[model samples]
Target chain A: MYQTISENQRHEFIAKLQPVLPEIQYYLPSFLDRRILFVMNKMGFADWQNFMSYLDNDHSYDAIFSFLMVPVTEFFRDSLVWHTLFHTIVPKLIKNDPCHVWFPDCSSGHEVYSLCMLLDILNVRNRVRIYAGCKSQQTIDKIQTGVYSAQCESMLVANYKNAEIPYDISKYYTINYNSLICNPELLSNVSFIHSSSLLEDEVPQISLIMYRNSLLYYTTDSQHTFITTMYKKMNFGAYLLLGIKEGGNIFGLQALFSTYNKDLGLYRKK
Target chain B: MEIATTYKLIVIGGSAGSFASVNHILQELPARFPIPIVICMHRLKHVNSGFKETLEIVSKNKVVEPFHNDLLEPGHIYIVPANYHMMIQSDMRVLFSTEELVNFTRPSIDVLFYSVAQSFGKNAIGIILSGAHKDGVDGLHDMYKIGATTVVQDPQEAQVPTMPQAVLDVMKPHYIFTLRSMIAFLKAHI
Candidate 1:
């Protein structure tokens, strides 16, 4: 006998599964099949057994999905973006003192490191205040520890070279068994907020908001809502850095921000 | 540690079928190969997601995406990230530019090859692999003029023959080999 999952049943499954599998829920629309497959493989069960077990245990689909959606990042993955920001953007932010920079959905903290590197290179680490928010506390802890893999170190070295920033990157980390633990001094001026992107009630007025490459998975309506929230949070003339392929005409919100084609597609609030 | 007086740097340029070629070459090289290998592959804009991870998995040596102002280090593979032109400095530092695209590619093969040739001169090795357009032709010629070792993938074996054939049409390289043979040649040289 073959059992079919109805749309309502899927929605019910998702609603039941969200709390335990937050990542999977976030990635559901885009990653349903992959998440299902991952859970099956993890449980060491065939398809039928896995489905029966999930059904019997009343397993939260969200928990299962969260386990599947990997949020891996490396330090300074894209160096040009950091270079443009340091050389062009941060200097402007420094000129406008009492600046606020918001990183919504900062996942782990590579984006944070990228920002810190910029502030350090520009010699204005003191001028700007950073507010980074993410949904996962585990990610926050990882960010707090500031430990990264050797792969991250290699990437960081490359980014430093590309930006022409002179800093001994090796000096920032102590090697321990193929892992590089970042110095604690780097996190002194930054503030970490453990909050969900969906639940944040009040966003402080910010001069620069960097939401890189994470909005691709959201539904069209959700993306509009998120961008609208960002528009509300940003002060006039605030700069927003988005993933290259992300900003498009969703909910006719294109006119709200003056789109600049620096590094493909970075937008500045008008 | 015996420091070699002269360091040989290899810059590989390719487009359409470059990824497979790179994997094939890197897989054949030993982990301790003591030379810097820089690659400039025309990548789609804003899609700088999996190049490094994929390359690192395939290659024996450490593979990473090049960052702005990074110093060139030996025993590593550096890939030019998407949407930026990668240039090498005489002091062996990396230079990144968002200057207008060359031959419609931001990470243009010609840009990297020309700068590397200028920086390393005779110590530089320039390789032109499979590509649809003739982006790296002039850069390979510049390498030839500067007495640098130039190699082009045998057109018959290349996925796209135009790029390698274009270089062969202008100046003869020191060696021409299929991808497999090219790996052997590079391994022997390094």
Candidate 2:
């Protein structure tokens, strides 16, 4: 029920891959071969050179990125992680002072909206500013439109229950025909920005960054550089959330941050 | 003479009744099973904790749910983690994605099979097992189109015949195996 794509998806992947032949060149040699061939097969391209023929058709970039992307994600993904964010991290962040949350690469608006609901329920929505940054204006508009398939309501409700956030799920959205329109007031303080790279337009004085599942798209070096940039910009003891699969494989940056929960990819700035 | 070394990889996919079949295969293989074997069996996203451990308890070879960008090792068994789509690169690195579910299931059989078709092609073995969905048909067909050895679990022997039957409805695979014959084929090849 939580699956949706951003219009900036093509551009964002292009931005991430612009470095090396659409960035496949920079993938660990092993990753490059594995993914290239996989993509070729999925798209019915005959071979490597045929796949590389993407340079010939600009339109093919979208198709290529679509295959590679874990592009759409659900709300309250890894419910345990959201629970920890609400019960443990939010309290700590609020105790420090007025706070801001950045979803540095929010391809889908569900997670961003999920966080807003939690903040509103905590009655701390007034104290916090949320910035939802996306690569394309289409995604920005989609977030603003805020409608979801009615079928997704049950899934979202289950996730909310699992996340242990206390609130009536029905109060957030109203049903129309076959869709649910999220209440727009949730984002009264949330700002939408058309920025792909956090390295370029990062908002300073950030208390929390929900940059999960998006990191693996970059080559390892790019991953490191992005992390290092984020590390320097974050506030003292600020919280960083990563995808569950990413924490262990990030190579060496373990010393730069301490893990709040190794199981859920929550890290605290050193 | 061992594991028909001509094939570099084997990918198996299923839903519903595939667990026992997968468990039996892992239980029978020797420790040095030769080339890698990756399975994409569907399971609940929230039921993530003990699957790999359960498989390892029955496997002669080490079993793992790969982390992102992991290099696949020969003689090992890799299970696609829950809610993640898995694929292989030409270099044998296993990758995972949280993309929209293909065939309405993550750990899609088609994603893994089509990927190995491109990566290993004729040098791979693609197997379909018992399940309730048609997920493995296109993937197995991709492998067949690429000249990889393709096998379907005999629908008559399948716990849920829909999946194997679905593949049979499309095209003939190289073999139609019962779980017992499938084990014998592997042991004989080794």
Quick one: best DockQ, which candidate? 2
What is residue B190's positional error in candidate 1, in angstroms? Answer: 46
Top model by lDDT, which number? Answer: 2
Q: Note the chain A TM-score of all models in turn.
A: 0.81, 0.78
Off by over 4 Å in 2: A1-71, B1-4, B47-50
Local accuracy of candidate 1 as per-residue lDDT tens digits, A103-208: 8767667778777766865678787888887665666777889887866676667666776666666666777888878776777777888654533735578898
Residues A1-270, candidate 2: write the lDDT tens digits. 111223343334445466423334334443444454456668897644454456454542445544443445566778899888888889889987769888877776888888888888888988898887666565677778988788767778777888887778778888899987889899897988776456666586788988887776667787787788778868989988988777657754586788888678788888
What are the per-residue Cα lDDT tens digits for candidate 1 across B20-77?
Answer: 8888888888896788899888776434458778888878888866544466788899
DockQ score, prediction 2: 0.31
Q: What is the DockQ for all candidates, taken in turn?
A: 0.02, 0.31
Query: Interface-residue RMSD per candidate?
Result: 18.0, 6.9
